[model samples]
Target chain A: MEDVRLLMLPGPVPLPERVLQAMMRQAINHRGPEFGAAYTESVEVLKTCFGTENEVFILSGSGTAGMDAAISNFGKGKKIASLVNGKFGDRLYEIASRNGDATGIASEWGTPVDLAALEEALENGAEMVTMVHNETSAGILNPAKEVGRLARKHDALFVMDGVTSVGGDEVLADEWGVDVAIVGSQKCLAAPAGLAAVAVSDRAWDRIVEDRPYYLDLASYRKSAHKEPMQTPYTPAVPLFLGLHESLMMIKEEGMEARVARHHRMSASVRAAVAAWGLEMFPQLDEHSAYSNTVTAVRMPEGVADADVRGTVKKMGIEIAGGQDHLKGKIFRIGSMGAVSAPEILATLAAVQHALRKAGVAGVGDGVEAAAEVLNP
Target chain B: MEDVRLLMLPGPVPLPERVLQAMMRQAINHRGPEFGAAYTESVEVLKTCFGTENEVFILSGSGTAGMDAAISNFGKGKKIASLVNGKFGDRLYEIASRNGDATGIASEWGTPVDLAALEEALENGAEMVTMVHNETSAGILNPAKEVGRLARKHDALFVMDGVTSVGGDEVLADEWGVDVAIVGSQKCLAAPAGLAAVAVSDRAWDRIVEDRPYYLDLASYRKSAHKEPMQTPYTPAVPLFLGLHESLMMIKEEGMEARVARHHRMSASVRAAVAAWGLEMFPQLDEHSAYSNTVTAVRMPEGVADADVRGTVKKMGIEIAGGQDHLKGKIFRIGSMGAVSAPEILATLAAVQHALRKAGVAGVGDGVEAAAEVLNP
Candidate 1:
């Protein structure tokens, strides 16, 4: 018999049975009323999760498509300030540079964004500001409220990548003054990948460019959404939309407050386990920055290698993430987002402990027990 | 119990059970070998279906995304001649105009493209030429080979939308000198909607623009595909890729010749049924144009209301398509693309015949018997 693997990656977490079953059905007419009802329900749930009353559009591409739409729609040929602290943040900067005249406010990965630098850029005529609320690569939650505040002070549009944070963390988009907020289906929603939803404020709509990318055009989405049956401008991934609707319904059933609390508790359990194993956290959080509730990053021990930990765990049928890019082999990340509970977390922790011991690491404490303490309590 | 639906739309046809089952699994790490294997397999089969030795990249959006990529990548800032004979043909023109300086070579809907006007545009120094191999909107197969020949003579790039043709019909991209050929997963492949694949020739690659749209950039896809296991540059719709891989495998198992023959026979069955019922085919096919083998469009009878025909059939748990845009009540389309066989086609014809008789249309012949004659003999 094949072993049942557990997925613990930052995004694309294990999907719920409901979501899976939803995709198992046959194709439906995308322009029909049935698909429209599903689309409407998913959009309404997304608005609740995003904590916004603005118009939210779902793009058929991944999270990057949403980021591209966010930037290209309103930031084209305009001076934009992009804050980069990690891989996803750097992605926003890259997309911004491609669409607009962008200035990157770079900081070390797994660290807080330089707020003063962001403010200075805005003051120096940056008309738009873009940042990632949670940098999944570094497992650091950037200060979205502060960045939004600074952008608002300068009367600049603020675009935030909430791909990994919106559902699992506290994201009051309207309260934070986020002009455009983006989320991926596979992240905190525990749905399949390939769909990205973006919430656009009315203020941001007024600043949209006339010449925008055709596939990712936001204005076209708006026009289509206003039809009798809500529809995307182009053909959406119908199965993904069905799966997303199921996942969103699950979220609604559990309630956002309960879901966020579960996510927070799960991440806390993993952090506790890491500390118990004498591991250091990867991110250096400041007053404004904090550890991400969706995923946690830990520094590898002095003598231990990433393959020894993450690779070994993979052999044991549990998938964790190693650091990306330059941080490879230096840090490992544990994702606690999207329908993960105490059982999955404890099993992952036990696997990691076993892998560490097998790697000849001394002084490896009872990490599973430590995690259970937090999870059970 | 809910009645099982028989979907016969121009695209988004009923998915095969194997394809639907493939998407019912849990999410996997997209950057891992599992996803890479799936991506590589899908791409390989796509090359076989496209009959090309050139590189084919899969984008995580719909067919429009591929169209956008084809134009925006090489046609940007160039003079592009877009051939428009139907809705999807007009879409190519729309995308071309958005990304490049484009002139639409116009022809009436459901009519052959104006080859003379297209030749004139090419001689007038059009840098790129875009055409739809199968215009699904009007169920007309445009003359891609002739268009490609003209474009080649004028030294213009040829971008063809083979969305509903490649898997179900004959599409030799390289033989036809198609610079870039695009296909949708939901169409001829009979997979779920949301994914698009583009085959790019060496000539098209050499002329690709440096500053392209961030999400739909084909160059990045090519770069990522060159990696060990092959990958899309961004996070792909993992489940959709799995479904696509399975559908492509089914195509391979059936053999391209057999699949094309089946599609042709099914469309012929429909056309024979239409002729027996005394209905007119929608498109005015000229010497260079031909009837599509993936879908058939028939003009509505003069006395019958569209609701009395299509709506009644739909109520009987069968979903065929009415016309789009101005063709709304003027024509109805029956899709025979993908894995649909004699049983489904006969059922749909029977339903339509029943509806036509009930709508008080006189001299309604035995469409089912006529279709059966074509299907069995």
Candidate 2:
């Protein structure tokens, strides 16, 4: 059996062998100087990744686990508001609701957060407002800056789950007024999943110092940071942290601007190729267009089944996703997150064109060329 | 500046490069077949690591995070008995106390669990009992099998923390009549810390299936067991899993018997060398020792502090550990965990002898020859 080279559907995309080599180093004791240096440098790199001036810390769990830490830590039962537009948005509510006082401003799946609804929630004296900046489930990029401003106006902590957007899009945590921003290594950062990096403002930290789950306590982590290599209250997966450290260095080398531009170009190219194939994006056509630079969600063409499209891509050594909730079986989600630049995007678009033609879908002539122009631009 | 290598304390022995390579692989979506295949195989290897014939499952967080899954998942909230000897044993009580009703059978640190006391607890209609098979903090190994038999005699579940013992000791989950065996990758496994493997017997499964933390539910893991590669409930740390898969294969190739023999031999070598140097092996060592095959804790000389001993080892590029809790700065711990096997042990022992001599402990002499003789024997 041949080892399968992965086309990661959502994230952490494909990793370069160079980063894998760096991750292969031996695990250091978390309480050792070697680990301390690694942890400190890694946090510094995360600060770069988050584009935040506030201190950066990592949660030794999944992206959602960070959601628990962020909301449970800062909200402290002082009413919290969440934006719900996708599975991720629902997660914010579920985690916050379980921890303390929190409410979700509901929105339909596949739609971005209506800024108005969030504004209304914040106006009601919400202690914190949480939302997924890029809801991967629906492939919609919420206006995080707008949300952050609203949080500021209402004196609420602006907590954004930048799991999908941070590395691939513009995540100026400080400049954009995002009091707390979270990013998962598996997403745009392109590290393997397992580590979650979040930058919390001092205001947010003030609330975390109070009574909280001992295991997920951020206050304890704050004190332990730098003294040891990002020592968690619990034993972390050291290998993943090593991988994250290497991946962060790789991201810096690639240049954040370059990464952001590449994702935008890939999304634009994907749009062009889909347009040529007579398919439509799931987001409103040109209206309120804040599509994630990484993943493009598109509705199936008339007579085209979502399974058929996904199966075709799979057969051709390409992987695409399908709708998660209301749009399940109705749309195709193609990811351009992490390591998806000119060559990857073009190759995938070419494969998509071939797969669609094989599926009896027409009007995809010169799909590669159409995508190439936008991808390179 | 010299590139400093980390000296991992006994609990999270540093990882080797081979393990890190596996974690550096591309991050795949949790909902992908490629990952599914990897996840399923990891669980299978996990069963073998625990020497179990039952089932193996994985959690995506730290070893402690997985500990939460272990107790919270299988514990029935009924009367539970926890053998408390050291920090880790206390952790079992903490988990049991929070999620359900628990009775802690206290033992002084550095002393083994009194099976007679545990038997009394079990006989009192205790629904479950938890034990740390190897206590890293005090270098005590509770007789799990003896306690396991007691639990069986009273029809109570037997849960063992194999965190530092699994790959380092002869952990026969089934043969020992153990119901729940919790293992971590870092300690003796030579893999990085983060991934934890748990084996559940039919008896424990009944409890786990009845009520468990939703995220840590053993039933959900069981449902996904037969699903290709392996499918975890949440976004798994892909690179680490991949690395762990590779590490397990390496362990399998070595064969379980040979691996256990290696750990036992290493333990014997370290003990013989420590005794040869006239160093005390903790307060009045047990005739039937509770010492872990992975790590050996020794009492520092009457006047020479453990902290002083550890500092010298750090300077020599070898890492040693100090005692925890009440024993802090009184005892020094040296590990024989995998990756840093015979060669590393011999080197560390030599360094320890040097550190002791420097501390004005004149009983110290060359331990390399002594350790080497034990290794050959």
Candidate 3:
């Protein structure tokens, strides 16, 4: 790597200097007043980032922590429908089952989870349905709004994983009828990676109260939200939350729609340029690809190794990811993550094409010219 | 608060500048090689700070997180006896009952959790007994060695909360026969809060593997720990862990025994001054009156408001805690947490005397001089 600060790859994307400063600022007493002010304000910002009016609880863990809390509290004694089409989708299903909720779903890599099948599964009277808004594993964005609507119609709680979608996509937690939503500081939020957040609707809140484990419980966290300064039931990751506060403000300043649009613009250009290079688009359903502008997973041509492509491109400080699990070596993922611009995308595509040619892949033609045309056009 | 960059209420004690800088170091990819280095080194430091030869697992939440994990993992499918004598001890009971396993026996606040009662309670097929080494709530130190032997004799897991004791007192986790010992980064440890640790012996590890709850499951963390550049199974308070690493190094430089002595010297001075001032200690047990080096709870003179005294001391930029729960209005808890010296203790005693007298309590002679003489003699 040419530079130590790698902005690419996956989560924990390069943070803004201000966010680092916030995390570096003197650590505060998680229970004290100063930290409470920062934590409480950070919660407010997280609520706005998720586009919800409900209380937000920031946990001092990764995105998985929020996912665990959501299902454990609300999914107790209730069936949960998990929509799995990727690695993180499996993660959702696993955590749900681990939390004592029953989960069985059908999904295939590189394809959006079948909503029709999910509806059929809901016949068993699931109390909640968990789905990843952006399935980072396969680089596919599920039809969340439609799935959420279906979940509501079935009277099941709709818990959405917005880990990869929150900052890069226009996610309206309230409008979409999402009862519980999970988000992380890494990914498109461009903050340090330790903090995870959740926004709960009244429906989910009721379930939380009815079945709450003291440690993972959200009822107390919600009640304590308004009354006290943000004292975590435990000592929290104080510095990460402060950095999250700054990141949310930056997101708000850009306006959520504007931020999402910027991502769309870059993702579109990358898709267009990659197509011109004759690489197959891995996301099966094309028109339905309203993906979070953060990442795009593409199928590698026959004999062009995913590792070779990622390795060579990384040499130019443009890090990319290879598919995980079954899809590994079959596909590559390039991110239009935080601060990725038109020029950067154009440069990255050129670098990828060069790498493919270096690996002895034939039919690599005028990739830079195509990227330049996509950028200017 | 005057032109200070940060104001910590004594601790989540004041974080050293170097500690803050270290914590701010960019977040390393948890699965990456670099994180393995950090994880391994941190575990070593944690062992040193905890005064144990066993492997230490760093949980992401607060000190209570460790308590909950300890109780859940150690006493799975069995009952646990808990010696409750303070606010924190009550927390141990709550965590014991929070989920998975464990039953507890608790005593009233300001008492030594009656080791005799605990011994009897262990016979009810309780598999583990949890106790707080330093009850921050009532400012009393439970006889940990005695409790350890009592629990081990009964073949019960001996778990202790060292949140307020580690740096201030000798917590020989191994020598004391503690199967699972928990500690936080605040109070006597003299570090910023958020990180909590648990040292596990071979016996405890077997229990952790046998009964696991996924998230609080320390075995998975240990597996990932063995893999290089320190990695946590989940996202942790990255910055706080960095601060903790630095703070651990500092504790070593001071030498653990000397640090322990410093706390005792300060404790002796506080007790002598209280006696000279004719103020009674909160603990009813005499030997318990020896006190924790970090804190002491003193009964307010009849009719003197604990809040009033604490509020006045806080105005002078020295914040002290009022008794929690029922003890709220009855007594004042003065703490000598983190890097506290004998002179600082003398200054605080002087301030306490002034605050007490101003709140309409008549004191016996010069309190500061009395404290100094107690230390010198």
Q: Arrange candidates, best TM-score first.
A: 1, 3, 2
Residue lDDT tens for model 3, A329-369: 98888877665677667778878888988998777777677
Q: Give the CA lDDT, 0 to 100, for residue A2 in model 2.
A: 27
Task: Give a tens-digit lDDT track for model 1, residues A1-377.
Answer: 12439989898889999999998889887877888899999999999889999988899999999999999999999999999999999999999999889999999999899999998999899999999999989999999999989999999999999999988898999999999999999999998999999999999998999989899999999999988788888889999999999999999999999999999999999999998888899999999999999999999988898999988898889989999999999999999999999989988999999998899988888989998989888
Q: Candidate 3 residues B1-377, lDDT tens each?
A: 13233232324665667777876666555566555555576677667667799988877776876777777666655677777888887887777776535555667787666766777777766778888888877888888888888878888888899988876687888988999888887666666566788888897776663645556667777876666555787776666676777777777788877888877877778888788778898986756334666787888889877666876776666666677789888888777777777656766777777887788777566777878987787
Candidate 1 DockQ score?
Answer: 0.74
Q: Any idea what lDDT model 2 has?
A: 0.76
Quote fnat for model 3.
Answer: 0.54
Chain A alone, model 3, TM-score? Answer: 0.93
User: Candidate 2's residue-wise lDDT over B30-127, tens digit each?
Assistant: 66666777676666667777989987887677777667777777774678899988889898898788667898999787786767778888777788
Model with the higher lDDT, candidate 1 or 2: 1
Q: How would you order the candidates by lDDT, starting with the best?
A: 1, 2, 3
Show model 3 residue runs off by greater than 4 Å.
A1-3, A29-33, A209-211, A286-289, A304-307, A314-318, A339-354, A365-377, B1-11, B100-103, B209-211, B272-276, B286-290, B341-350, B369-377
Worst 10 residues of 1 chain B by lDDT: B1-10
Instruction: Judging by TM-score against the true structure, name the best candidate.
Output: 1
Q: Would you list the C-alpha lDDT of every candidate in the order shown?
A: 0.92, 0.76, 0.75
| Tens-digit lDDT track of model 2 for A181-242 | 88888778777688888788877766563645445567767777745335656777666677
The per-prediction CA RMSD against the true structure, in angstroms, equals 1.3, 3.4, 3.0
